[model samples]
Target chain A: MDTLNKIINWFTDGSSNKLSYHYFSRKFTPMAFIGPALLVMAILLVFPLLFSFKLSFQQWHMIEQASPFWIGLDNYFELLANKQFWNSFGLQLLFVVVAVSFELLIGLLVAVLLNREFPGNKIIRALLLLPIFILPVVSGLTFRFMYNPQYGAINYFLKLIGFNSIAWLSHPETAFAAIIIQDIWRMWPFMFMILFAGLSSLPEEPYEAAIIDGASRWRTFLHITLPLLKPTIMTAIILRTVDALKAFSEIFVMTSGGPGNATTLLSVHIYKSAFKFWELGYSAASSYMLVFIAMIFTVLLVRNMFSE
Target chain B: MHKFKSWSRWKKGLFFLTVFIILFVELFPIFMVVTTSFKPKLQIWTSKSPFELFRPTFKNYLQVFKDRNFAKYIKNSLIIASITTFIALFLGSLAAYGFARFKFRGNFLLSMGVLASRMIPPITLSVPIFILISEWKLLDTYFSMILAHISFSLPYVIWLLLPFFKGIPASYEEAAMLDGCSRQRVFFSIFLPLVAPGLVVAAIFTFMLSWNDFLYALVLTSSRAKTAPLAVSEFIGQFAPEWGMMTAAGTVFLIPVFIFALGLQKYIIHGLAFGGDK
Candidate 1:
């Protein structure tokens, strides 16, 4: 009892043992601040991740109501063999590459154009940012309405232009292109916002030097701005790429991966597998594959971000 | 600055024209939705030109509020988002402050862990989360939805706020400590208030994320806790098209965020500058 009391005193009695107390608080303070968030992450994120990882190796159908039986690599083997899985994987790659490329190019152009002093530039930038905050579900619904074959605003404009109205979301190729267009419209501003911020902060010395050397504006931009903006560009692209891979609500609301699976990205495929087909284990396996793909970019992103 | 004055009349006209075209294209869809909300049903279907002017009606908004139980969904979304924002801000700021101020072992790894967690696709976790929520019999509960939201929002809040905390000079805290203030008091009265602008930005962004969330709400809540986004999506699943009510609901759902984004544009821009860089 005496020993226990002394040990407790050693911890609590700051005045008696100032050195120990100082060392203890230094270690304890950060943990006190950080521990709760770490605990929450472990419970909500880490645990579920491990649980899903375990489920990937088992065979379980939600509708069957049986226990998840150990299937060992069978689910992975089936996923590898599934034609739809490969198709979705290919589509996922195509979607991310195409959408991100257009967004980067267009976003950089707009940012460069608007980086100059202009009237109403602030309002225009703010207005451009509105789409980023609007709910994806709402955007999807609006785009769907705008793509309606009979009454949509888009087809109406096509008619005004003397072109035949396209059934935008009803056909396979058009459906894919339609979603990509909507995504670009919705996301380009993100790149613009980041690149615009980067552009605004760039040192004026480079432009001044380039002007003294009589370098053309285009050449100066390619040589000076591109190199300086590389970090911000990399950050924006990787962030968008990871987010684009997880694009679900917009696509789900727009086409529901429809026109006969023409637009099924990996995320949508996993969703349909779990909910529509009730293949829980299979979906878990597919989701891990998605995590794998995202992690590659995420690793590069983190390294790129922290390297400086 | 002289470049503008040096430009020819045609070049100046072209510049303004380009700006006008960009604005019009970007905002047209939003304009369509907002205007469609005010259009009478007959006008919506019969109007040949999307830009045609007409007398606006409040009937769609009236019906959405009276019949569709949209009020409940909005209430759920408000309750869940507000609570999640509050809790996330509290916990996330503390963690961010720790990561910024302390040079303890594994700080970099832990901070990176939080960043990496933020990048985890929510869809990837939806399956296990759904099963877990159901197992705990938490489906359709506000608790379940808020938990799921906080899981995503907390990491983001931490990531966003870390740079803000790091930007503050250490002398402030040291000065306070020497002035007989306890560490807790110093953090609350000094650090938090100093980071108030950051807190505001974090609050708005976190609230916006929670408010706009769809997947977690979809998986975790069936009816009682269904969010505004989910309810808006449900408008399309019905047999008959309800564009008027859908647009009205969407407008209501988005108006608060639009106001936040525009009204707080300065702070958001500052936040984005930091958000993009680090």
Candidate 2:
């Protein structure tokens, strides 16, 4: 028994084994499979993100034609003082509030109904999913034409119902509203998919028991379905909020953050700072701030998810 | 009893009403685009007729092809999206398998780290990534967008497939191993075949994500790497986005996505609705 224990200990000890060819191969296999992907994600994604985070502390403009001067926290201070930054920040918040709220309400409705085996459900669902596949830029381009005041589909439809065109993307307040509305058109389908899954996966026993107890359908839905689907609701909100916060391409195409920064979210601000005006340091700082905000929401969401 | 019956009837009526309105709102915009695409150039700007097809012509579709070699854009979108879907699903699956099967240090952190990378806003990374591409001097190249799309979509593959892989029976692979098949061989023969439905879903989704991406294409590529959306965005400038041309382009743009969505609708719908096939 002692000798047997000694043999086991000998194999277990790494210093004794010197990693035999068999051991080498066993340990080596993982790196061979996972190494390349990790490297790519690290270099292209992780490294650039870290580099940007570091650069956020520096003061640099592309116009300077020199290395970025390290200016700690001043860029953040500059952003705090900039009223335009605050306004755009307000607009982004408003955009998320409006977009997420509408998508959730409409999406839940759609998912509840679509969950039942109805006529043409598959085709309707497919059509619904179509917008998800349409590139955001293309959605913007298509809707941009649709929002055309004189000759677009949206105006034509409104005119058909006897209302005049509504400067959907041109007017400042309406510009932000227009982007939110269009975003809802694209986003609800995704929310629908998530909620549909949640609803479908809901055990029917509680629902059946409620029905047997003479509880009304609405009561059952409110008490049973809604409570059961809460996790799904939370997931959708978190994911959609993350996306709505980062909304760029559509806003870039639709408003260009225009009519005096009406729709400029953090993203467009970051873009203009970095590329358009070439304020690399300030943009990097702004980018870090955005990441910080996104990470906070994400952590809250993930914790909420796992806890439940 | 009568009051309860009335309320039930009213609730059913409200349900149908909700579905109807949602369907109309969700689908009508796409319907409008489709109908407008067929309108005559003379009436595209002038006609307010939503239902009338009086001047229906293939003129817009013809213009899409003849005017700009839009066929090339279409071809490019197909090639780029297909390549991305294939490579991402393949490589991502291998990596997921490694992470799932191997007892390595930091595997959970590494796998979850994949999710973290995804959670980072693409907009946050775009400028630097574009700079990296430009420095690599790969600007206006399909390679850049392809690489960029792979980063985001690959994680999705890993995330989606990990759940599927975890649920699947590993005993079959173990059995095959006892039959003298290598781990890689058993993986191909047993694991890959078993999870095909899930893979179909992943392929369709990865394809859509890559196809739908715009910013990388916008910033990374000038002309050479212009995907379909980039091709469409090009028409719009300081002025109005050339309505007839925009209509023509948008219609052409919707077809491939529509076809793919229709084709993979089942796999994707199932995967998305329940997380994965398993």
Candidate 3:
């Protein structure tokens, strides 16, 4: 019995035959607890990621080859000089900046407005989450229908207001803008909820001090609320930026990266290259580039989140 | 003093009016989708205002229901989402407990790795996952989706639940241990009950992530395992979309999620604030 227990302990805790029951349990328990999650992570995430990295260096078409052959630096070089690749990268950057900015600005404003007590406040707050919870496909389709120049509600509204009906998703610039608008509509509620939580939990002392100082509302907002709310706002910005950079399904549905690759964000670009065009190696490389760019922002986000 | 009171009352009125407008704008698309789903096809084309009332009909919804593929997609979505949620919660809470309770070797690094996985772009993995799933001949199967979803949701599950576990007092587990229970037994009998609300929050998030998934389901599944999101996207075909049917499908997608959001608003807020899944 003692030897059997020792073996179990040795396997679990790296301790030898001289193991105490308490020590074995204390040191090895976490392994038993975390083992399944680690297994799942390794199998599903780590393996595919490593495989993708391997494929990024290989040359093969999924349809035309039995196995990929090593072709060092070819995919990377091709992407570097590819105008379409560069265009998509630039568009992704623009998308992230515009979408995250609008979401943060509007979200904070709504949070400030809805911060005070009012009738139906809870109901309105709850209703706001509907947009956040709607499936991206639904939002994309609904917006696509609404943006339809012929019989769409948006164009109809423009006509009612005596303005010319603009093709929201037809032109390159407008297509890009339409995606941003759809993203903001889908995501701003997320920002609003986070900021509202931040606003409500704020310590009262600063506000009282600002009030006693007879500061104007704008001054108090600038000095007191803004400073106090920076962490929450930063969190929202980091999350929104990371997500906006990867915006795919909605853009996939809404414009299909079209009116001539105008709305082709990085993810959509990779999708088309991989599935539609069968440029698997090139697609993998593009995805890695995206991962690299996103991780830079993600590192900042993680550091900011833990800074407190 | 009377003038000042009147002025404040006017300000309150203005505030409420602004709040009402914000609420309307927020709900505008949803309301249009729901209303349009109920409006007949003729009424939909004729209605000048998006907000106009029409004689409601279930024809669009009936058409959606009549499609056999739509029902299969809904069933697939429910099965995948629920299974994924169950698996994620089971595995994630265990890892979270490990982090919360033990000072193991490489704990910080491992926790950071999990969080980092949360940040890794799923699109980056989609290509390889597609190839690998096909290699294993698991494409268009439930297991493939369940595994794929577990990859994404586990990180979020562990991250969201870790704080909840840390918030739990250790004394309860210790007390159970003193009563001759094993550590695992203590976790299940004593600690699990205490963190039930946290578990629910984690489950809701996992379900939402799995349910709202499109990119993965779009790439991974083809015929046998298509999800509702994929089905809804299918409504926009090669040519013009069927708007009435699309709105009807969109409404079906909206109802359950909206109900869940309303019912679990407080928990959802807490989860989101903790940096849960988008």
Candidate 4:
């Protein structure tokens, strides 16, 4: 930290030494720069995270309401060995992978389609964005009602086409599937927006060159369009994966991590452990673990994106 | 590689159809919500008959606005989002200017740390925030939620502002300095105007994140300070979840966000991805 301060001070001195760049020589006020942000962020977030960190070391289940035993690492030890915790973590991992992949593919296809110079494409593009704005809480509950066997739109549509209603939310396999499908629907619009932005921004030079080379449309897209879109595609995937791993509002609104905890991802699990079950310490530990997983994926995403 | 004008008529029709089908699927859920909002209460609950709207009434909407606290919820959301955006932007821009114009120590770590804060799932932090508010005796107050939201929005603000600051040529600031303008004067007159557009986009994205926030509001505030999404979620409870009331609330909540997005969709498209991969 001293080295850092010295390095910064050196830059300040050098710039001030030059009469042309002396405005920043305001008598060394470090507080003015990082102050407001620090105050806001510290009171709201950093303090809270640290608060949760210390709270996690104590026991807070039914044993204590206001005060707890300072059982260092006990909660984490139990959580680490807990079968249910690992299972839910595994579920979240799977959900993030599958959901992000599907969203990226569908979103890319929509972007490609929207990128075309069609007559009614503007209206389609506008309409395509409707889902991205819909609040996840409402979407989740609406789907809960929609997936209702007796009154759901899905079952109703199925019967109209002479098909039986699939037990959409109650059954284990279908419940998770239903949430994934709903998430895809909710998320694809934003993905579409990003991918479309990328496609639109691409210079026509590469495609033009490919055309002169007698490359087929498929070949040009594969060799040129896809390669050029690498960054945007990574952006969409990273954004989707992070959100998917933290999928809470929808699942909380819809399933509440129920039907024997089959749909309880790590986040919902954290919610249950902390708020619903009143185990603050255990929940805090679980949340940090959750943060660890998210960071891992995020780092991997950054690495992959930069690698290309 | 070929222009669409050279395509055969049959192929053109196929492409059009393909586009339509994809858009239809993409839009089906939103379409359902809009259409359902207009349908009468009984028609929605009784899934016995679908695709048929026997009666239409504004009663559900009327109830949403009049029966419950939809109006209060909207007012709360608007106030919180607006204040958060303003305060955050004011502070964020100043800090960004400071970091950009001034040479700083631990700048790299601090910047990376700020960005890293955003990567953590919000759910993880809610517990700590809840505890903090409780400790500070701020629970159930607008301040609690607003403060909580600032933490979430700040990282994005810094990240967004950093690039715009970097993009501004340093010669301009140097010139201002040479002209006997103080550092603060240069920031206000010279740099602030240049970064205003980027600031607007940053504010919009931050405001939306706060307005659309559910978890913080859900855990941090009770009924007195509840936002629209939180109020909307209340329609579902342990027993006898009121479908009509919920859908009514949902529609009202959706309308403001939808209208805001529709009006500013272009701004959103251009601006929200400020810190995003360029």
Candidate 5:
């Protein structure tokens, strides 16, 4: 009873105890704020990550109803020897490069065009954002409908222009190109939004000096705008690249990685392995490879973003 | 503005023409989907021209609602997305405020952890999450789906709201604390209202993330908690080119997103641009 009374007095003594109270609260307040998010992250993210790593080293056929047995690095070795895996990896690289390139180029051009004052600019810019929000499944379905060789809009327009109708998704090359086009159509606005913002926020002093020096518009853009916008461009590229690597819903809806495995992106490959083949262990390994690739880009992004 | 006025007549015409072309290309597919949603089955299948005039019909929508169980899926989507968005916003804003204001030991490392977690591919997480959810017998339930959705949305919310909190002047809180107000009071009354735009952006994004999710819903839920995107994708596989119904369903799925994009255009742009900077 005496000890309890002394402890209470030590804490509640207003003049002498205020510093300790403040110190304890200061140390705890942030934890109270951040603890829930960290808990969720741990349960959902970190746990899954560690579990996946463990699963990658085991052999678990989900359909077998047998316990998973340790298989060492067999999955990784199998992945190395797997032609289909490499094919999917190559296709993913191609998709990322082509889709991001077209999006970046077109997005930059449009951002430059819209950066200036114009009639109905606000409405056009708002409309530009519509594509970004369209569900990927919807985009894929709409594009598939349009790309139908018979009675489709794209074919109809092609016939109008005196060009013969062509099957878009039935063949491998066209299917790859078609998916890339769909992706570019859906994603360019993201790039445009960022680049446009960067353009608008650019300092005017360089342009003012360029005008005084009689530099041509193209010269001014090359010298002034591009350099200043490098950070934004880097940010946009890294973000889009990571997202494109994860592209699944639309392509899955469109082709399901069909046409003799022509459009099997790494994500589609991972999905097929897990769900279709029920090779849970192998799928976990391949997904980790995808994560490894994504992590490199993420590391670059974090460094680029936080270095300043 | 001066440049536009000083341009030659032909240059000005060319500029407008360029803008028109870009808009036409970008918006054409959206226009096609919207118009096709209104077209009759016969018109959609046997149209002579892409621009052929026809009377609009809601028969496809009627079929989608009457035949397909889109309403239930949409209900599931709404409930799951709303819950995830609410919880994510509350938790994310608190953590973002901590990272922005508090001088903690792992502040930098923890913020980086949040950023790195944001980059984790969902497919990678799907396998373990599926196993764990099923092991716990939580599969096909809204609880499982909501938890999975929060895995991604929480990080995004934190990443986005961090800058908003940091942008607030520290003096505002300092002054509030100097008064009789407590820290919690200052946060609720002064800080949250000031960051209302950021909160709105985070809510919209988190909602959209949950609403548009397909993979986790695919793996996590078999039927009961299936979302609209998964349901809509299933439409394609069930039949042979049901273009009218597909377009109608697609259009319906897009309506909420369209409302969000158009209504809150300013704040989204600000968020995207500001987020891109960091």
Candidate 6:
């Protein structure tokens, strides 16, 4: 009975001094708590990553294969030499930079304007979030329809301003710009909300002191508000950067990586290579390239933003 | 503060003008969708201004409802989303408690692992996951998509819920432990009730993630478990695309998310801010 009590006590309270039981519960309790999550992740994430690593080195015609054969460095070399793959990679970088910068810029400007209390502020804030909440696929299609050259609203508006009715999605440069516009519209509010939260939480004493010193609004904003808002801005930039890099559905729907691969971002490129071309090995290699690039970006952002 | 009060009439007009312009840019496309969905067939193709007011009808919406595939897609979406949310919240809360309460070796590594899992782009996982699911012969089933979604959402749930669990006082659990309750019992009885709001936040966020996902659903489920997004995308691909029908389907899809975003604006904001944390 005493021994049993000691066992139960050890298990329950970590009170017993027995090396084995102490070690067991010490390790097992936390495992008991976190093990299911780890297991789920292993099956769903880690295994897939390792499996893809192996597949990326192998040659397999997805439909014609009873077995995949290992091909050493062939896929990687092919992807390196492939102009289409490199173009897609460069385009993804460009897309991420342009879209995220515009979103941050517009979001900051709007957030600064809307930071102060005004009538119907709550209503305006709520309405601003609709684009963020709408389905990406829906947003893509809606924009696709609206960009129609002959009957679209955008062209109609452009004609009202005396500009020619441009084929927004038919030209490569305009098609890419059109996709960026849609992305900015959908994602800018995310930046706005974060900045607004930061703005509201800023210390009032600094602004009051600036006012007493007779600082101009621009000077006060430049010195005080901008410095204080750095962390939130960095956070917004990092989050938007990550999201823009993985953007797929909108580009998939709006242009399908057209007109002529102008907007073929990495995600869309990977999807097409894997599913459409059935080049499993090549697709896996390209995806890892994306994963590598994204990880580097995230790590850099985190280190920079959180180091202080 | 003084600037706001001492603003001239022109300044006030500019402020309101900026606000109105922003509002217009935000809502005009949405309003177009709503109006176009209600337009009859002939008016949809007209060269007249897309914004010009016309007689609205329910024909497109009725057609969407009458289609059998639309109903199946909604059912599949609901089933996949609910199951994913349930499983993610359940497992995620438990893991969150572990991270929150226990300061053990490798704790930092494990928590970091949870966050790092999110960094792996979903596209990177799609090929291997698709192959594995097909091999298991589980493709196009609720189980496959639900598992995929749970995998996608669990890391987020664990991260979001961890802070909430940490916010609960440890003394309550310690007192419960003194009274001879098991840890599981204490968690369920004492700590869970205190973190009810956290659970609600996590649930809604998880639901939204699963509901909004298109890539996983596109690859994993073809017809049997087709989601609304996939259905709508496919709808756009048909020859002689009906703009009215597409808009109607889009509007129907937008309703639930719109209500959730507006009604739970605070929680959404709180959750997003939480997500932005390191």
What stretches of model 5 exceed 4 Å from their correct place? A1-17, B274-276
| Lowest summed lDDT window (length 10), candidate 6 chain A | A8-17
Give Cα distance to truth, residue B156, candidate 5, Å: 0.3
lDDT score of residue A186 within candidate 2: 91
**Tens-digit per-residue lDDT, A1-308, candidate 1:** 35533433343332324575477667776776788789899999999999999999998898886679989999999999999999999999999999999999999999988887667878889999888877999999899999988889999989998999999998999999999999999999989998988888899898899999999988998999999999999989998998898799989989999899999999899999998898999999999999899889879988897887
Q: What's model 3's lDDT at B190?
A: 81
Error of 6 at B29 (Å): 1.2
Docking class of 1: medium
* Tens-digit lDDT track of model 4 for A232-264: 788778867777876888898988887788899
RMSD (CA, Å), each prediction: 3.5, 6.0, 3.5, 4.4, 3.9, 3.4
Which segments of candidate 4 are over 4 A away from where they belong?
A1-31, A301-308, B47-50
Model 6 Cα lDDT, one tens digit per residue, A1-308? 35633443444544333555456656676776688788899998899999999999998779888778999889999999999999999999999999999999999999999987777888889889889988898899899889988778899989999999989999999999999999999999999999998898899999999989999999999999999999888878887787787789888989999989998989999999999988888899999999998788667665764575
**Looking at model 3 chain A, which ten-residue stretch has the lowest summed lDDT?**
A8-17
Candidates 1 onward: DockQ, in order:
0.57, 0.37, 0.55, 0.52, 0.58, 0.57
Docking class of 3: medium
Where in model 2 is the C-alpha error above 4 Å? A1-26, A63-66, A157-164, B1-18, B271-278
- Cα lDDT over the full model 6: 0.85
Task: Label model 5 with its docking quality class.
Answer: medium
lDDT comparing candidate 3 with the true structure: 0.85
Q: Where does candidate 2 chain A have its weakest 10-residue lDDT segment?
A: A7-16
Choose the strongest candidate by lDDT. Answer: 1
Point out where model 6 deviates above 4 Å. A1-25, B1-5
- Looking at model 2, residue B4 earns an lDDT score of 25
Better of 2 and 5 by lDDT: 5
Off by over 4 Å in 3: A1-19, B1-7, B276-278
